[model samples]
Target chain A: MIIVETKNLSKVYNPDTVPVHALRDVNITIEKGEFTSIVGPSGSGKTTLLNMLGGLDKPTSGEVMVNGEKITGMKDSRLIDFRLKNIGFVFQHYNLIPVFTARENVSFIMLLQNRDKNEMMKRTDALLEQVGLGDRKDARPKEMSGGQQQRVAVARALASEPKFILADEPTANLDSNSAMNLLDIMERMNREEGVTFIFSTHDQRVIDRARRVIKMVDGAIAEDTLISVEAANQ
Target chain B: MKTLLTIAWRNIWRHPARSGVLIAAVVAGLWAGVVTVGVLNGMMDQRLNNLIESELTHIQVHHPEFLDEGYSRLFIEKVDEIAAFLKQDERVKAFTKRTITDGMLQSPVKTSGVRIRGIDSESETRTTNFHTNMMEGEYLDSSIPNAVIIGRTMANEHNMELGHRVVLTFEDVSNQLTSSAFNIVGIFESAGTDFDRRNVFVRSSDISSILYDKAVFHEIAIMLHDEPFAQSLAADINQNFSGITAQTWRELSPELNLIVEFGEVMLYLIMLIIMAALAFGILNTMLMALFERMREIGMLISIGMSRTRVFLMIMLEAIVLTLTGAAAGILLAIFSIRYLSSAGVNLERFAAGIAELGWDHMIYPIMSTPEYVTVVIMVIVITLLASLYPAAKAIRINPLEAAKDS
Candidate 1:
């Protein structure tokens, strides 16, 4: 079943003076358990599409229906609530609170939800261990490496128990080894837990690992293609 | 709220040196303001106390016509009855009747106009304690005929001394001129040089014998244990007596009262000025804090922290900064006030300005509990007001743009 769908989504920046078409008439859908990557060259609307899909930016013209509910028309305040409850985001940089420890960072979303303390702690510990930073739970963002901090961000994104996560170039700042390890862990989580993820990236490594790749040109989708297991292995 | 405070509290320490400097500035500002105002308040209090003790008693009564310059038109009727009434009133701690007249005071070589007060010496001493401040000879030896006590300034200006007889010329009640040679039996020096020069005291019986057809008085000065009740007592006296005007110390010395009130206004003004300076320091620091953490703030909002919560967090940060600093400052001030109040700050070095103003050369810093509490409350209020600018700046930021700032 499709967990996310967008219909004819468009976004324009500085529309009155110097209109920049960031996204145009984008139509896309992602199903549960799919590992998707939205890929494009520079200034090709990949990140804008992700932003529209995540409800961080309102589309100038069209609908973003996640789980069959239109979120594009929601107020900014209600959009925040919707994002907190039903969606997660991982930015290019780690974006972990510099003052919060790794475990606290992971637990922040649950804290926003005002969840039970013991339950939140248990889930946070499990998420940290799953990200392979179990022993580094007390480490602050500044005290951790780029890869470690991104893992913390991932754990944070998952803490709200959202239906899907949108990662915007999650490994852009990582070294090659850290990038591979982070992609491997995300892929494993996608396969084992059926946690849907759609990320925007220019990285070929991320595009190679995605079960499906959506390519963009200018501001609209140019190609949407699925990779078979055998073809992906080849 | 807990989440907001946690973030705020931690954010303050993110740059310990910067936050510490802000706190230190707050501490130093409050300390200087409180101590300076306290010392000024002490000086004003001393000035008032000296005025009341050495000269103006708490309440004074005069025949309405008697406030003019010469003794010819000034004399209170029914003096014995008024004196009897004052002696019976429990609120009247002490009272003295004076027969006052402006006259030419003739020394051996020079002459000066003076206000001659005919006083029952013992009663005058009880009312003003001028006897204690007498610097030479004796306080009106009634045994010596026509004995007089002159102030130091008048004695110095005239080159007069003890046992030097000066002829005083004035108008009697019949409008006839009279003169008498009264021996200077004592000399007294007081805080006010002008007051010392203008006033000279003589035995009431001696002057009244020549000036009045019957026993009478020009004024009645009343002292009280509760100085604040002076106005009420004066009102009572005025109402009870048909032809007299009873005035409180404040009414008699309006300019002095104005100066004391102005001193109070100056205390608040000082607080406002200090707070204004400190407010800018805090605003600059907190704004810098918010600017530096724009990405983090954007991340928080993007993840769903409400703008109200963000606003509250920034405000909490400002409050913590001010409260911490002001509390430390007030504590430090309390300690120093206690020490300086007991040990006293000697202003003999500022004798020309302070001592010449008729206050003692030493001042004890004075801040009552209510005043200290007022200072603390004012600081907290000013800090809350100061936070509005920075908190609005924090909340007005667009998360999308801020997150993209990189």
Candidate 2:
């Protein structure tokens, strides 16, 4: 069953002069449990495409239907509520609030959703352990390694138990080993919890790990490929 | 809300030097506000008290006709009945009846036209500082048929001594010329320069004698236990008596009343300027912080914190800053005012200016409960106003752009 779908979504920036085509005529559909990568070269609108899919940015013209709701036409506030309830985001920079500890960063989304304190704590602790950062929960982003911070960000992204997660270059700042570890952790969550993971990345390692890959050029999809069982099992 | 306050408080301490500078600015603004208000309030209080203690009692009762041309008219009849009525009122602390006449007091060297207040000296001593402030000799002995007490200026001008006789003359109630010889008994000095230079204290009987008629007092003065109660008491007295007017001390001294009025105006003006500075200061700080933390704010919005909550968090920071500053300001004000209250700023050097302004030269820094309470309220108001600019900026902050700031 399709959990997320975008139809002919396009985003245009600086339309009148020196116009930049950020997204153009993008069509994509993701099943309930899938690890997908929107892969492209620099400035190929991969992040913009992911932003559109996650309901973070509305398409200039077209529709983003997530969980059967046309999110593209929703008000900013209702869209925010949709995002909080059905989607989670992990950014390239980890984007943890500098003032909060790793555990607090994970708990912030649930808190904003006005979840009960005990439930929030339980989810935060569970997600932190799932990301293998149970011991580093008290450390601030600045006090943690790039991999540790990214793991905390991922833990935070999962704390709300959203149907899908949007990670924009989740391991772009880490070393090869840390990157591999983060990808492995995300893949494990995708397989075990049936949580769909959508990532935009320029890194080939992320493309290699994705169950499906969509390659983009300029602002439109150039190619879409489905990974066989052989590739996933490898 | 708890998270916002926690983050705001930690953010304040994140850069101790910056916070310190802002806090210092707050402290200085508060101190200046407190001291300015304190000294002005003190001067006003002194002026008010001196006016009440030195001249007008809380209320005065007199025949309505006496208020019109009564100074020169010599219309002192029915004084005993009025005094008896006022004395019976429970709220009346002390009351005095006095005959006042515009007359010429002449000595061998000088003759000055004076407004003579003829009093029963013993009752006046209880109600006013008349006897205590007398600079020489003694108060008029009413039993002495022609005894008088003059002002120090009068004594200095005429070089008169105790037992010296001054000729006091006025018109009789029947509109006939009359005169009397009174022995100089005492001399007094106070804030009233005109009064000291020209006024003479004569027994009521002497004034009656000078008028050559059975006499009554032109006015009655009533003292009260508290200054604030004076106005209400005066109103009650005025309402109860149909043919009389009760004049509170504030009404009697328009010049002194200006000090109180001026203090209120100056306080508001100072608060406005300080609020402007505080708003700018807080906005400048918050904007700088927002500029630097744009990415963080965008990230929070992306994580589903509403734009309204984001704005509220920033506003919370501003409130925290101001409230902290206000706390510092109040402490500084209390400490400084208490200190000023002790050493008391001496404006005696500005004696001429003080005299021209009709304020006492010595200013005792005064803080009434209401005035101090007002400062606290001002601090809160200023802080709330200061938060507006920062909160507006935070609300307008674009989540997409802010998240991309890095």
Candidate 3:
């Protein structure tokens, strides 16, 4: 059930002028339907690992395979197509398109997939309703609260039924109450819908809710721990 | 594609004040460009039309030797048949025959060299504006012996009034120097003072008796319903008629043709410069907007929108911006031009200067549909060209760098 695997992956920025190792020989695997968190302090390469795992950036050296298909050697255009069918992303600042209404934001990915209108509408409505923005479907991102925008981003990510969703510091900007509400919804989806998710976060709230925790120090994995059975029963 | 266009359209309004300023600039630029070119073109057309109507009729037929100064031998024969043919021709609006001779007019105070025309009063007025140009006295009368007309400028120069007698000296058919005295019955001043002072008119009967038979003429001027068909008509006349040459107004007055060509080139050049300025404004605005949304655009790329679609979105935004502005400009231009065209833009204040170019005191501004279509197409092309640099920049943005907090 492994959805994404990275072996001996490394990324170096400005190698010739001033070499800075962002991620060094990192190895990781993410299984389907698993809610996991990749935790590290600033500059510890959590973002770099997530970027390569999602095919958003190329590793300086190594292999990245999603659903058993190697993506490291794929052409940029083909990688984009592959990512559309296999991966979704959520940013820290709730990067939902500012011009589109909440419903339009959710329907965007389905439109890219060329989904049928009726089915796309049904799915968009269902996702927005699940994210508790059903009544706020026509509201634009600027009109929504920070937490609501993030929920719309989550709904948009799910619109294409991507195999896994990668979220970078997803709750870093939310207040305590909004943070808890967002985490509650995400945890509920993780349990009920069996949607695979991976997060790069410094937020303890997201870390506490996730069933698996992958910790990194100095661009290398220091720990990988699973507590789904224990966390689910709690 | 529909989704991309909708997103592009909405994106432009993200900064409504900024986009509004850009659109307003485009609208103002186009309005000014169209109106200026329209008025200038109107002036040129009016000048040409007046030349055709008041001075040079559409086509003129002359004896091969008529251009030289020998007035005795340069006369067209078979005149009655030519006049009859012209009357039966459907394209001929009017025609007049004249006997021309170079002579000197002597008054008590002074004298001047002039081309003396012997015009049949009835047919003369039909082909040209001679009847309407009379400022005093009357048009030529065959009944009054030795009756003549002189231009107002010439009369003023000689300090002569109506009923003043002037002397004309010219050669007879036998090349004999003949002299006669005539009464100035009318004084007329048309568009230009220079043209008026250099010519005089008299009844063809008064002068022709000394040169040839009463019916002989040196020149035949013809006016046509459709001015553009003059060249073809002249060709037909030249091929069928014998012992005569036919020439169009364009051939006779090459300066007028030159003005028309020059005016059109200047108009297009002015429009091109304005559109280029408007294009720069669009490029600056779109580039700023794209740069502001670099991370969002990066996120869009990460979320699987193709680079081509991203490029198209930015270009679409530019096109939509120009189309809205250009549409508004066209509306404003149409309304203002239509109003001014009916009311007329008077040039009487500039008449003295305008008259030098044979232009009238009033001009009507006009723009044809093809000119409007050209403006629209040119605006769109300018906008599309402007979008290239920014679109290329948008596609080159790296998602990883944009997503990182600096």
Candidate 4:
């Protein structure tokens, strides 16, 4: 089923004095359990598109429907609630709260949802183990390595059981081995749990791992290609 | 709410040094405010006590015309009846009658105008404890014939000592000038230099004999067990008596009444000024903390923390910070006031200057419980006001922009 769709989406920065077009009439569809990557160079609207899809920023024009609800013009308070229940985000810099432990960082989204203590603990422990950071649950972000912190971020994104996770250059700060290790865990989760993920990146390895790739140039889509639908099913 | 509070509490300690400095500023501000008000309260209390105990008793009675016209003929009528009533009243601690007349005292070298109070020596002492203030010699001894007691200020000014004789001249009840010779048997000192210089005491029989063959009384002063009952009792006296009027100490001294009323307003004004300063310090600190945590706050917003929750968290942080310091400061002030009250803050070094203003040399600091409660409520209000701008700034942060900036 189509879980996310965008039509004629556009964004303009400083539209009054010195307008800069960040996205122009973008259209895309994302299916359930799909591992899709949007690849582009600097200022090619990859991050802006991800922001629009996550409902973090308002589109200048057109509709972004997530799970059948038009979110482009939703009020900020209502949009925040929608995002909490439907979408999760992982940033390039591993944005786990520094003051919170690895387990607290992962369980924070559940806390925001007001989950029961027993359920939150059970799911938090299971998600941490899936991300391969079960032993590092008590450690803070500052105490963990860059790779470990990023894995905890992924676990946090999944804590809410969102329909899809939007990752913005998730491996941009990791080493080559750590990048591969992160991709391996994400791939396993996508296959085993039928979790959907959409990524915006410039990394060739992430692009290589994606089952479907959409390349963009200068705020508009240049190409859309399906690398392997059979491998994604297995 | 619990998680929000936890976050707020931990956020304050993110920069321990900065938080510590702000807390210290709050402590100092509150401490200074409380101490300054306490000292003023102490001075005002002492001044009121000195007036009530040493001079004006709780209530005073006089002929209706005596206060308006200080003539010797306007002495109170039916003095025996009033004295009899006061003696049987349970509220009356002590009472004294005096024959007062404005007169001139002639020393060996200089002459000065004085108000002569002729009193029954034993009752006068019982009512005002006037003999406790004697600096030298006896207190209006009846055996000495024309004995007199003069204040220290008056004796110093006239260069008179114990046993020196002086002549007093005043108009008699029939409007004739009468003169009498009296020897100074005592010299006393009081807090008020003006009162000391203007007043002298002599035996009632001596002055009454010269004024009229029949006894007369000009004033009746009553000391009550509780001063708060003075107004009601004075009202009762006015309703029951004829040809006489009774006045409480407050009515007799309007200036003291004004001081007592305005002193509370002054205390609040002082507290407001200090709290305003403290509010600025807290505002600056909270704003700085907000700027430093912009990225973290943006992340929280992106993850679905409601704006109301974010606002509550920020406000809670400020309240916690301010109340912690305020609690410490109030405890310190209370203990300090109690200690100094017992020991007395002595100003003997400025005795001459203070005495000239009718104030005692020692003061005991005092603060009521309601005053402390007011201070606490003021601090909370100030903290809320100070936290507003910063919390608004926190919620206005755009998560999209913050994500890119980070």
Candidate 5:
């Protein structure tokens, strides 16, 4: 089933003085459990599209339907609640609260949801192990490597059990080895846990691993491609 | 709520130096405010006690015309009856009759105008605690014929010593001027220099013999066991008695009343000024914290922390910070006040100035519980008010823009 769909979405910045069209009539759909990537050069509206889909930014004129609920005109307070329950976000710099430990960083989203304590702890431990940081649960972000922190961020994004996670340049800050390690964890989670992820990246590694790719040039989609299982494996 | 509190509590310590400075400012401000109020309160209490116990007593009665016009003929007619009633009254702790007359005191070199109080020494001492203030000689010794007690200030000004003789001249009951010679047997000092300089005490027999055909009293001062009963007892005296007017100490000394009333207002004004300064320090610190943590706050909001939660988080941070400082300050102030209350703070260097203003030079600092509670409430109110702009700024952060900027 289509878990997310956007229709005729557009965004304009400073429309009164000097209008900048960040997104122009963009449309996209993602099925449940799909791993997809939107790739483009800088300032090509990749992040804006992700923001629109995640309900982080308002579209100039369009509708965003997630799990058959229209969220385009939702109030800020309600939209935040919707985002919390349905969509997860991973920013370029691993924004794990610097003060929270690895386990606290992972379980913090569940805590915001007011989840049961025992369940939060259990899930946090399991997710940390899944991200291969089970032993570093007590370490704070500052004590961890970039790859480990990003893995923790991914665990945090999944802790909310969102329909889809929007990752903006998840590997941009990592070296080749750390970036591959992060991608391996994310790909494994996508394959085994049926977790859906949509990434905006210039990194070829992430684009290669994605099952589907949508290319944008100058605020509009230039190409959309679906790679077969054989091609993805290759 | 727990998660919010945890985040808020951790957030304040992120910049230890900045938070420490804000906390120190709050501590110093509240300490200074509370201690200053305590000192003023102590001074006011001491002054009030001195006025009531040593000078005004609780209530006083006078012939209706005696206070308005200082005519020697306008004496209370039923002095014996009023004294009898006061002696039997349950509320009256002590009472005394005085024959007061405006006169001139001649000390060989200088003659100054004075209010001479003719009193029975035993009753006067019990009623006004007057004998405790004697600085040099005996109080109203009847054996020394025409003996008088003068204030230290008056004696100093006139360069008179104990055993010196002075002459008092005033109008007699028949409107004829009369003069009597008295020996200065005592020199006493009181809190008020003005009171000391203007008043002289003499034996009732000597002054009355020269001024009246028969014995007459001008003033009846009554000391009560309970000070709160002064007004009601004064009212009762006025209602029960004829031809005499009764006045409470508050009525007799309206300036003291004004000081008591205005002192409370001044206390709050001082607290407000201190709190306002503390508020600015808190506001500045919180604003800086907000600006520095913009992206983190944005992330929290984007992850589903409500705007109200964000606001509460910032507010809690400020409260925690301020309350920590306020607790320390209050403890410090309480300890200091207690110590000073027991040890007393001597203003001997300013004794002359303080005495001129009718206050004792040695003050014992005091602060009541309600005042401390008021200070605590003020701290909370100031913290909430000061955190508004910063908390609002944190909630207004756009997650999208913040994330983009990051």
Candidate 6:
């Protein structure tokens, strides 16, 4: 079943002067528990597509259906509430609050949900162990290595137990080994936890790990391929 | 809300130098505001104290129309009943009746119109610090009907000695012309305006005999044990005496009130200017910080933090900065003012200039507890008002645009 769907999604910038079209009539769907990667070159609108799917930005003309809710036309405050309760995000920079420890960073989204401190600590520790950072729980982002930071970021994304985790260029700033580790960890999470992964990336490693790859050229989708269709079905 | 506050604190220290300058500006503004108000309040207190101790008592009771129209002829008779009533109230520590009249004093060479204040010498002396103001003569002698104490300047003008007699001529309350010869027993100096210079004191019995109404008195001055309760005492006194007016020292000196009020208004305008200028510095610091951390703020927004949270964080930043500065400023102002109050800020060095301007030569700035408290409250209120624009700007920031910023 399709867990996320977009129809005729389009984004325009400065229609009066330059009239730049970032995306045009893009239609896409992702099934439940699928690891989907959208790959594109710079300025090819991959970030915009991810933003639309995550309800962070509204497309000028489109309908975005996530978990049976049309989020594209929702009010901004409602969209924020939806994002807070149902979605998690990972960024290229790892985006850990410098003041917070690794475990604190993981627990931050839970705190946003106003969970009790005892429950937050429990979930934080479990998630840190899940991401293999159990020993470095008290370490701040600056004290951790690039791979460690990215692992903490992934742990933070999963902390809220959201139905979808959207990662935008998650490994664009890491070294080759760090990128590979991050991709491996994400693939493991997708396989084990059944948390849907939607990544916007140009990294071939990430694309390779994805069960299905959506390729974009210019401002339109060039190809959509199911890498392990039989395995994904099972 | 707590999450926003936590993030706000972290954001404030992100740029130590910039945030430090904003804090310093706020501190300076608070210090300026507090110290200026404190010093002015202190000076007004000193002046009011001087007025009460040296001249007007806490409450002055006079005949109904006498106080309103300054008519000495309307002096109330049988004030013993009022005096006895006041003596029963513990708040009234002391009371005295006096006769105030305008007349001309004539010696062989000099002649000037003078204000004669006839007091029950023993009671008036006990009720005030008037004895301390005597220059070269004895105070009023209630036993002698012909003895008087004249101001130092008046004695000088008449070239009179202690043994010299001056002839005083005036119409008594009965509209009968009368003349009495008074010995210049002493010279008194009260550093008031020309009013004090023209005053001559005599015994109340002497004036009562001449006026042919020994039961009459011009004013009944009451001294309160607790000065703060003077207003209530005056109200009570007025209630007791249906037709009479009971006035506190503050009401008698509207000009002084105006002066103090003018200083306060000026200080408020100055504080407003300082607040705006300080806010400019803060706005610069906060906006510069926001501009530098564009990507950071954008990242926070993208991570499901709402714009409202970002706005609240910035406002909290401003409030923290102001409160910290206010704390520092309050401490500094208090320290300096306390030291100054004890040792006193001597205006004697500029005495000649101040005297030429007809102001007091020695000025003691007097800040009370209430004035200091008011300064603190005002600093907080003004600082909060100053933070509005910056906080609003932070809230309206678009994450997409901020993310694109370099």
Q: For candidate 4, lDDT tens digit of each residue in A1-234?
A: 999999999999999999989999999999999899999999999999999999988889988999988998899999888888999888888888887888888888999999998999999999999989889999989899999999999999999999999999999999999999999988888988988999999998998889999998888999988888675445
Kindly list the per-residue Cα lDDT of model 1 for residues A59-132, writing each as its tens digit: 89989998888999998889888888988889898788888899989887898899999999999999999999
lDDT of 4 by residue, B1-406 (tens): 7887777777788788898888888888888889778878998988888787876889999998888888888898879998888888888999999898999999987899999999998888788876778899988865999899999999999999998999999999988999999999999998878889999999888888888888888999999999889998899888879999999998889998888987788788999999989999989999998887787777778877777778888899998888888998898889888987888889999999999998878888898999999999999999999999998988898877446655
CAPRI grade, predicted model 1: medium
The model with the greatest lDDT is 5
Top-TM-score candidate index? 5
Instruction: Give candidate 1's error at residue B92 in angstroms.
Output: 3.6
**Model 1: lDDT of residue B356:** 46
Candidate lDDT (C-alpha), each: 0.86, 0.80, 0.86, 0.89, 0.90, 0.78
Against the hidden true structure, what lDDT does model 4 obtain? 0.89
Q: What would the per-residue lDDT of candidate 2 be over residues B24-105, giving only the tens digit for each residue?
A: 7887887787788788888777777776665577777676666667643535345665667767867777888788877788
lDDT score for residue B175 of model 6: 71
DockQ of 4: 0.62
Off by over 4 Å in 2: A229-234, B65-70, B104-113, B130-132, B135-137, B141-187, B192-195, B225-245, B255-259, B355-358
How well is each residue in A1-234 modelled by candidate 6, as lDDT tens digits? 777899999998888899888888899998888899999899898988988888878788978999878999898767776887788788777777877789878888888778899999999998888878899999988899988998998998888788798898988889998898888788788888888999999988788788888988777898999877555444
Q: Please give, for every candidate in the order listed, the TM-score of chain B alone compared with the true chain B.
A: 0.91, 0.87, 0.90, 0.94, 0.96, 0.84
Per-model TM-score on C-alpha atoms? 0.92, 0.90, 0.93, 0.92, 0.97, 0.85
Per-residue lDDT tens digits for candidate 1, residues B1-406, read 7777787788888999999999999999999999998888888887787788766889888888676555555677767777888888888889888888888899878988888888887888789877777899998855999998898878989999998999998888877889999999999977667777888889888888889766668889999988888988898888888887889989889988997898889789999999999999888998899888888888878887778888898899999988889999999988988898988889879765654456777898888898889899899888888899988988877767533737
Worst 10 residues of 3 chain B by lDDT: B397-406
Candidate 5 stretches greater than 4 Å from native:
none
Badly placed stretches (over 4 Å) of model 6 are A129-148, A229-234, B62-74, B80-91, B104-113, B135-137, B141-147, B150-196, B206-216, B225-251, B257-273, B335-341, B350-377, B401-405
- Model 1 chain B lDDT-worst window of ten: B351-360
Q: Write the per-residue lDDT of candidate 3 for residues B146-242, one digit (tens) a residue.
A: 9989988889899999989999988877677878999989898777777778889988878898676555688889999988789888998888789
Docking class of 3: medium
